[model samples]
Target: MTIRFPVLIALILALSAVGLTYEIAAGRVLAPFFGTSLLTWTTVIATVLGGFSLGSALGGIVAERPRAVALRNVRSALVATAVLMAVSPTLLGLLHSWGVRGTDGMMLSVILVFFPASVCVTLPSPLLAKLAIEARPGREGSSLGFVLAAGSVGAIFGAILAGFVTLPLIGSTATFAACGVAVLLCLPFVRGGQTGTPGTTIAAAVFVVFAGLAGTPACQYESGLSCLHVDRQGPEVRLVSDGTMQAAESTAPGEASDDGTVGLALSYTEWFWARMDRDLGPDPSVLFVGGGGYTLPTKLLASRPLAEAVAVEIDPLVTKVVRAHMPRAAEMIARTGFDAAEGDGAGRRLGIFHADGRVYLNETEQRFDAAVMDAFSSGSVPAHLVTREAFARLREIVEGPVYVNLLDRPDGPLARGVHAILRELYPHVEVVHGARTSTGRTNVLFAASRLPLAPLDSLPDRYSPARISDARAFTDDRGWVGHR
Candidate 1:
């Protein structure tokens, strides 16, 4: 029943790795329902950490038992942990189906699905360490140190594995299953542990495999950045990322707008272009900060064949999906590595740069006739992209009017904060609403330029200039827009 010290250390490392993998992968698993917002990440992280803390406490009590009894419990815990981790994807899906939502529901679901498995994976660590110490009595310090070091090292390895390798390569469902199988595989290494029946082992293995195969994937295409999928909304195909519909375009054959351009499916897009047409000159050069589905840029290329449209999208996979799935987006342009700033006299051209919008703005020398701030991470605009410093850089690059699209509560802090900063840089700043005043979230647009924005005033539901004295401007250091 004796296990070597090196083998014991390796087992602890593997167990800790599995535990952390589950923690990191939980965000991607919850994204389809929660939108991967700051709130979702915060809740997931806290709940997992809470479970680990509770498990360590439980492990301390169990470690006080006799060596044989403690080791026996470790084997049992690992098997149970494996079963729980394997079933987590299914549990989350069922919870979501039953209408789990909002901050409270998110917390409840994480507690129910992720918390217990975290506890089980961690509960054996102390037990294993206790056995290791008892086996080599005089080497207690080094044994304890090695056990702790193994857990820490394993955690680091697991994080890198999930973020860079497995989650992106195999997707979240497979990653979760792999974590379970890893925990189960640790059973044999526990010194003095009871040997479970072959039937039990086979049953656990089958359940893990079934769970891996049973769950519907969160997206058609998943990347480190998002869970991306294409959805059909009547005749239009929409690109959805992390549960938020980023862009939509009409798929109906021969469908065209009154302006003889490809029809835009989203109302907010229609309103944005209508206002920008007045601000932007003929044969205009446009810069899109975020190219979700590339709907607006495609419309521009179709309507104004002479116009130049450059889109800087962060995730290449998203643009890839848009080209393959969305209507007309496929025929628009090939992704060639071109300098987005190099504006040689080309009659009509489209450039798609896969980089952070803010970073692209900072590095590019190309100035544009107009710019659109449409970049977002899930439901929230990435805080970095909306900072005052980012806007100031954008202002320098874009000479004509700049249009921004965002979702926030009607006249919410984010809308007001963006308005405040834009006003500081531009002489004329206006807010246009895509929806009537409501308690819930809605699309809000901010138009800013050095010149008078007369067109924005004509748009329906113009937000009356509110006293924004209390609205805190978002800076690079502190960008706290209200959480959706």
Candidate 2:
């Protein structure tokens, strides 16, 4: 019996949509463990493409077989893909629970979760092309065009729907499961690709049962941004992102001391107190760009009682989490009433604005005595912020000094490029790194100001700049992405 070309076309479209969704979701799935960085994207993309290529080759070889044989292969491929897609997030979740992290772990997760499914998804495209050739003999060119166009349209729809709707609503784990179920629905819509024999059915059932038992992507909280990785190692409550601990609190029964400095566990958090020689204007206002776990700002509120502070963090969920769970932040907010709204305004002691740092800086009239910029992830710095224009904007808004904590090598392109950009506006710019600092991230800080240099040795073990041969300044138009 001949197949309806239109039915095959529609199934192919659906398959294409799911294929792209899997590819996109793979990156997000691996982000919490791997970090949503260039390297991570590159790995996911490369692995996905490799699977597609492998499937295409296998499909091309099988397309020479009889029509009945082709349909059997297609049937098996679709069912296998559905099973794997359902389990991908669960597999990643298991790895996460096992404390697997970093590049190697991420690659392993991608290979296990994504590669096989991608290969299965691509198997049908070549088979569909050959089947169409038999259905309509001389319409080879049109068959190719129609199939390719349908695939593209469906992929676009899948990406948009997954990103804007499914992810924001049901979350990553459920989204993966739903996409799998969607692919299964297409089997009925297109005729002839029926379920295989009894043993195959039992095997599929067994996989489903096992996958269901793997549990949802394990996390304290999850969003399109990042997973809220909460860990209780001992007495400490930790919030980690990308295996880099953002904040930790000492919470234990019958805790003896209640000093303000207990939460400043990382050197980077303590570095917020390290200031320049020049005085901030009277009644000083300070700005913190990113409030990861609210550790630094909490420390500042407790230590610098006289200085008024303003923290602008983009993620409201993160702000909410810190205020609710973190002990020191909650206690400090309660004591000062800083977290409360003061007549449609932020508190004087510590005003919090949930907004992008650059946008907040551009709009706010309040000139800060100091600004702490902790926005950039170690692997992914926003292109716009690293430019000369951004530095200029900071120069205009900040009166005293602007301190930037960067996770870059002293001689790396990022450090040198940012150094050149800082020199564009500030008369005096100094880069320092501490050998044994509180921050375990091992980041370098760039102190940019329009004044003379202060005594560097005041802070113990501060690593001075190594050397600069021929550094280049990053501008808004020129140097956003190419710095690395």
Candidate 3:
């Protein structure tokens, strides 16, 4: 059986799309456990590229075979690709449950779950190219060029569709299954792949459907920024973003404060508000760099009722998830008329702007009495948001002390680096933590101000001052990237 040039090129494009979709979705799937750090992305890219190179080598060997065998093997390879793509999510879950974590675990997970699928997806490309060449005999250079261009262009489409469309629309698990289905669909259109039995393809399709159905979804809502989910622990409702608990509040009777009022759940927010209470007046206008679950912003509006606050949350989906799932936060947003669409036009009590914190800071002319740098990507502050240049601009906009929340090992480089940068700009810079031991990762807060700050010795044995003596500062040119 002879394959048409157009049909063969279409197959190449579609398969390339599925392969790149798998690559992009791999990052999202690993994010919940591994925290989409620089290391995670680096590992995923390396593993995928290694697998593709190996598969292309194997495909070259298959291309040397008789046409019938080569085409038959391509069909079998596509079937394998479909199976692997569909089952990868479950495989990742199993690996994670077995205590797979850290750099080693991340590397292992990517190699085991994604690498084989990458290999299978590209294994048929050489064989398809051979068919394309045969269809147009002496136009070898043009045929190869078309194949190469189609594959590259298809990858671009897959990346855009996965990042902006499928992953956000249907979620990571479903997206993985869809990629498998996409590869399987290409099997029917391949003209020369004369497989005697359709039994394997049918079996693989059934298995992909079963795996998709049986797999538990990791997130309630997935956005380009983070995986959003809600969890209930007793009466406390917690909002998790990218496996990090962003916000929590008690809902049960008598679980509120002694005054019958609900307050902040996370300890860092309490520290932020404590500083705000000491420095700012009741009607103080505050700027929040990151609005995770909008917890602090909601609390500010509830307590002051008319406190003008703007929360620049990067992901609108995060705010949407909080409004739908977390009742307490939702009530405060509705009460304050905090519509993201209004964009500072209507509600001054609480304005919600969806944008990168640093970009918003650069663009806005509005000034505030104080600022809270509560924004984070996974466990660490986004590199640009933590740099010396970023803080220099922030100090200009915010009149009083600027509070920053970070997660790092006790006196880790990230903490020390950020502290070093802050010291260069502010007259008074201090690092404090609630943890007792100088070990492991803990929430470290940096309070930098033009004016002298009072000792944060309020809570029992909390806010222990950390010394920052010798450390390199993070700048826009040399930004912090990895998890410490």
Candidate 4:
């Protein structure tokens, strides 16, 4: 009628491992919806720890019950948690497919998919501790410490296994289903927990496989780095990252106007010509620092055959998908690395490099006539790249105009702070508010150069003259845009 000390510690360890495994799986589940940003991670950590804090406190109270009753409750909690795990992937995947977008969608999905199981999985930890202490009455402190430490170590293992092994190798469905089955392993340790019947375990295993079959997450591509989602509305095909619309490309083709004005699907990209070398003449070697949809590069190459073009993208999977969408440019990316013969000398050619923008800029010997930075959106700009040191390096690599397209409000830290930094980095800085009305703006483009910028008038809806000055400019030590 007594539980063994080692067996009780093992059960507690399994319980903790299952808890952390589910947390990692929750991140993968939400990646296509919330993105894997600082904000998203903050939310995940809070949600998980919050549930555990509650469950552990309640488990302490449950420990006062008769041993048989507490063990029965532990078995029941494990079963319920596993059943929810089986259903979660399909349930959340369907929610995502039904148009879950932005922060609200992320919170809703987390509440549905993670909150219940997180609470259930930890209920047995304190209960296992109580059982162990009762079995070895004089060694209570050792029993508690050993059981608790065992749980923490198990969590560490679970996190590593999820990231480096299971999630990538088997995908989210099987990984989650496997975690659910692992949760059931703790049930055998429930004292008098089993009825000596295979019926329930057999049923749980079937449910795991069946739900896993239903659990394939909606994704354009789910890589170790990201989850991509593609959406099309009319001729505009947009690439979405972490639920945010990162870039848009129009399938509808158009030529330059009679006056030599270029056409583009996104107004932000169109702003590139507002003060760029491409406006003055041909064969200007241009570097595009972000490759979201490769829309800007595609636009540049199409508009000027003599334009030397290069796009540096961090995610090769994203690049590959967008390349398929832009076959000619994709062909160029695959065939060319850094230097290629200009297309018309025979022609100006484009080369793509799969590297981080900062690493590429620092490492590449080539100096660009102009450079475009569309690498980041508002909340998740790479902190290291937003600093003063990064801008100084960019100024070195780009001898002419450098245009930075930012999806931020004109007055926000990203637009305002970066605007201030550009003036210090380059002599002539012009802020082009791409989506501005008299009321406000959300997308701002910073054009800077050592030379004079071309005369540009504030056009209605297309672009307007804008500026912001503030005490905040990002540095490598300070960390990130939009963070105060």
lDDT of 1 by residue, 1-484 (tens): 7888888889889988898899988988888877777788888899899989988899988888876778777777888888898888788989989988877888889899999998889899887787777768898998888888999999999999999998989899888889888987887677565566768877888888787787677677998888988888788898888878899989776778765657778878877777776677668989999989888887777677567888999998987897788747777755322444454424438877889998998998888989999988888798888889999999998889899988886577888778878988899876766654333777887788899977444444443333333477789998854374
RMSD vs true structure, all candidates: 2.7, 4.4, 2.0, 4.7
Q: Worst ten-residue run, lDDT, model 3?
A: 339-348
Tell me the lDDT of model 2 at 464. 47
lDDT of 4 by residue, 250-315 (tens): 555564444333355667666665455234457678888877877666666655667777788787
Cα misplacement distance, residue 390 of candidate 1 (Å): 1.1
> Residue 4 in candidate 3 has what lDDT?
90
Q: Judging by lDDT against the true structure, name the best candidate.
A: 3
Candidate 3 local distance difference test against the native: 0.83
Ranking by lDDT: 3, 1, 4, 2
TM for every model, in the order presented, reads: 0.93, 0.82, 0.95, 0.81
If the candidates were sorted by their TM-score against the true structure, best first, what order would they fall in?
3, 1, 2, 4
What residue runs in model 1 are displaced by over 4 Å at the alpha carbon? 258-260, 335-348, 436-439, 456-470
The count of residue-pair clashes in candidate 3 stands at: 0
lDDT of 2 by residue, 184-241 (tens): 6665543464446857645665565555445466345665565667777777777776
lDDT on C-alpha atoms for all candidate structures:
0.81, 0.70, 0.83, 0.71
